[model samples]
Target chain A: MFHTTFYIRRLHSICGLAVLGMVLFEHIFTNSMAIFGPAALNGALEMMELIPKPIFLGLELGGIAIPLLFHAIYGVYIALQANNNASNYGYCRNRNFTLQRWTAWYLVIFLIWHVGYLRLYTKGITGTPISYELLQNYFQNPVVVVLYVLGMFAAIFHFCNGITTFCMTWGITKGPRSQNVVSVLSMGLCAILCLITLTFMGSYLI
Target chain B: MAEKKVRFVIERQDSPESQPYTQEFDVDYRPGLNVVAALMEIQKNPVTVDGKKVAPVVWECNCLEKVCGACMMVINGRARQACCALVDEIEQPIHLAPARTFPVIRDLLIDRTRMFEALKKIQGWVELDGSWDVKDAPIQNPYTAQTAYEISHCMTCGCCLEACPNVGPQSDFIGPAPTVQAYLFNLHPLGKFDKPKRLNALMEKGGITSCGNSQNCVEVCPKFIKLTTYLAQLNRDVNIQALKNIFNN
Candidate 1:
């Protein structure tokens, strides 16, 4: 019954905001604890580790993995189909239009490397819970640090810009004035998140 | 000083299948002359600035006003009504081209069948069972009626489509004009009976979901229709329709 593109598009948006967005928020916030030094960061990870393995696995699989997969895959299809003429029609919204798609493409690669290297490969190989020590060691690599910096910015922009469009898509912001307000608010949120993330990364470099 | 002249670089196509090329012309300038008038002058002489005699540029217009959307073309890189595009207001070497969103029939003329087809798909009319006159008709809220009146100004021009990145050779989007029309018709008391039908059509591919909401449509719309607002309203309506379909089925 939900076979139409209309439903599918809405479902994609729902997955992005309801599922992926929440997870990203939690991830950034938790990781930001690293700015307080290893003890605070380890404390946060230890708290997450308190959840039972089965429940954690279920949450990861259903809440994060499946939805992220759908969002990325469907997102790629949408990106490929887009005919971006932002070069010709270089209006502010049009530039954002092109940037949204480009950022999606970047996130696909960044996510694969970020999640794969950390979540799957590291966890699989080390056979240890992710802790401050692990991230500290991981961020020791200058290349990884650069990658993470760029990746974080891309993710933040995608999510924050996404909030504006999501509002429009679901009929939240109806007019140009309301849309401008929402865009400003969303960008402010993006900036704050970026600052927190940068502080988190700074803790590693030192 | 020499006689005032308006320079024009008009794009011409021999046939629908032929390649389009630009031809420059000099139209003797007149005060308050519009782009359509400039084209008319060029048609009379049918000669290029380089002194080559050629077939008159083919274009379409009626009413010579902005009300009829027939005279719409790209004037100086913007899709607008040539009738209202005054010569003095626009930059010289006035660039004229067919609104490329629709297939170019020839020269500055384009085939707007796709827009009409989209209108037909949306059932963009108040359907009445019979011509029998009725004494009592439901009154509409003045506010709602005003909004509907604003949306009703759309003349099926392809300017919105021309400016839209989504509606092109690469995409299947029905574009903003028809979607706004769907909202316009659905606002009517008599049109409410077919709301389900219209919403279902919008639920399909190349429908409301196809809109990327870059908002170029609203920016280019000559009628100043609140296209994005109506689109958002329809987005809400169609989602409600989908939910109804789910439980009712």
Candidate 2:
């Protein structure tokens, strides 16, 4: 049997890559629809609206929310217990390790509030049809806009750096050269993600 | 000419149970003085900056050139051997302390028995089973020999463990050096025969997965062992071992 700490860690990595990662990928692609136009974004939303309510609720709870909640809570546990001696040691990955923990925190806070506010307004509470108007109104508030930008930054950073870590930890990147490839790829991924996410965000303001 | 003076702010504890406090010493700085030499100078004097005669600072050392690995301690906020830490290279009022990761014995020493335990748990040695030296010892490939030579440089100084974040009294991360040791033994032909056993040990609690790959170990290792690289290899090997277990069993 795998060691308990090791097992939990592997599970954490697995849940991170397989479940949460897919959700982020899907959400990003879907949100990138805004780059086309508001109508395009709304049309994309309509297709999603066709999924039966119970099934949709189930997907949100089972597929995204629950797994995400577990990943976040467990991440918090690990981050809290983990220490970083990077200041003394001055290693590059040690800095990344420390930054990963910080980004984990930022992502958790932003996700909770973002998900709650958006989900409740659109589905759980208001049942309002999401449109450019809704986003515009949302972004009108300076605080909301700031939170969204910060949240987007945290999520992208957490995801991108996480990809690099995932590769090494799982042995997918066995050596330095291969890991370097993964690192560069993840950085590119981060760049694309930030551009699209922020581009759409700016469109909402415009 | 005025005596070139060096000041030290070192953490000390009288006994394992006693509280730790800071002690200061001012010494006549000779050119090319290292922390170990400075400690020796202090040991001879046993006097404080405040002019109080105190007990000599206790520390461990041998092969003062940094090879023996006995002289490791945190010098100036970083963990390294006091032996090679030349005085002129670093700042004055250098802060010295026992490695915080391990429990202190007295002044600058801590018990590194857990490291030995980790090595034992991982079965670091190649399995001979009383066949100390086989006449037909397997000839090695040049590449494998090169990798093995790199791993053989580890001196068990406990720097990797001390600088690591996850390692402490509460956590069971066996540190990085032993993981490289596992890979080293796994590469030997006879050692390769028992590879599954060693990999299985790695699968045990406090094994390879505990490493988050912050890589402070590689940075701080005086031997300059590519610890994370071996860890990366060991990670791959462990997975293959798991797969083998699944199919063979």
Candidate 3:
């Protein structure tokens, strides 16, 4: 019989790679909003806005619905499978697998609450334009700012760590030299992403 | 710098046909010295504890770095290259033995011919057909170049095979390293030309499906190569190749 860990790792890789590509696409598109001015972004949001009465019920049942449910269920499965409880900080061991498990769990919970608050209810209450101004205002709140910072940090760390493991999983970094290079590069990339998020939030919000 | 005395209990055998025994020795160590260095000190003076003279212990070392993979032995029960194992970092009374996974040649030396044979069976190399000029070989996509650069770092260290449960005496499973190497070649622009041949090799009994996904191979690989990722991708590639073959037939 196949070990459950293999299935989980493989699934996690699939999810991580696809999600990473999606996030990257969104980031580029969102940043491009600057070119057309804040009104353009808000206008686009206004154009695509969903109705709140019956559609709200549909979204609640379907929007953050099926995909989120399936993702979370499988996310938990992967998190549980990747965990190595026996290690308990043993000497002479590689900590990659254990670290991957811990990071996955942390990100899944954080993402759920983030999406719940940001998109689900706030969109209805604020009824505000999804412009740069609105983004600045949302981030200006201390709690929002701190939460965004922490969430972005968690996401970036989890991302780089996953990418490192992904390299290993795909046999890309085949040995010590390649691993050392990828380790250094992954950390550098994560730092760059963190800097971009923090600088933007810092300059615009504060 | 002062010389520190290091103690070691090494498993020794005179030849492939001989019986084995534990031999202890105390050797003067220098800063940044390794298990192999201490063994060399013992070689200079083949004396054992309790005042007994003996034959010099035989092992292997080349490059004095971790690249050659010739210096792999069990240090404190962990399979690693002795050249990179610093004496200061290791716990005292460091026990040394030839890696039990391979046939013991003598004291601290093992025959790693099994790994070489596995590599051979997979034809783990770019076919050197002389048809194309060097300039005309298809330029690699930058992404492909980046991925290939990572996969090319394998040093043929047998740690992955040693840790793999399926790659044992009773089984013909090719283990993780060789399989991953095959995929590396398969990804090349020109290397893709031989995709069918390599996929056929993978479809054989010891091919990609034989991997049990115990993941022990990835855990113990000292080089930190991602064994499972290539294995999974290879599994997908082989399945696709089989479908294509069916249509062609």
Across residues B158-179, which tens digit of lDDT does each residue of candidate 3 receive?
7766655456555567778888
Predicted candidate 1 versus true structure: per-residue lDDT over B17-90, tens digit per residue: 99999999999988999999888888899999999999999999997878989998998888899999999898
Docking class of 3: incorrect
Per-residue lDDT of model 1, residues A1-206, tens digit only:
34469878999998998898899899998999998889998999889889999999899999999999999999887776677877657787778888888889888999998778888888767677798998888888899898888888888888888898898898888888998999899989999988988888998888
Clashing pairs in 3: A168-B226, A169-B229, A170-B229
Query: Lowest lDDT 10-mer window, candidate 3 chain A?
Result: A85-94
| Model 2 pairs whose backbones collide | none
Which stretches of model 3 miss by more than 4 angstroms? Answer: A1-206, B1-3, B130-137
* DockQ class, candidate 1: medium
lDDT of 3 at B38: 84
Could you report the DockQ of all the candidates, in the order they appear? 0.59, 0.64, 0.03
Cα lDDT for residue A124, model 2?
65
Q: What is the lDDT of residue B167 in candidate 1?
A: 87
What TM-scores result for chain A when each predicted structure is judged separately against the true chain A?
A: 0.95, 0.92, 0.68
By TM-score: ranked, best first: 2, 1, 3
lDDT of 2 by residue, B88-118 (tens): 9998888999997887899998888888999
| Model 2 vs. true fold: TM | 0.93
Error of 1 at B173 (Å): 1.4
| C-alpha local distance difference test of each model | 0.88, 0.85, 0.68
Highest lDDT scorer? 1
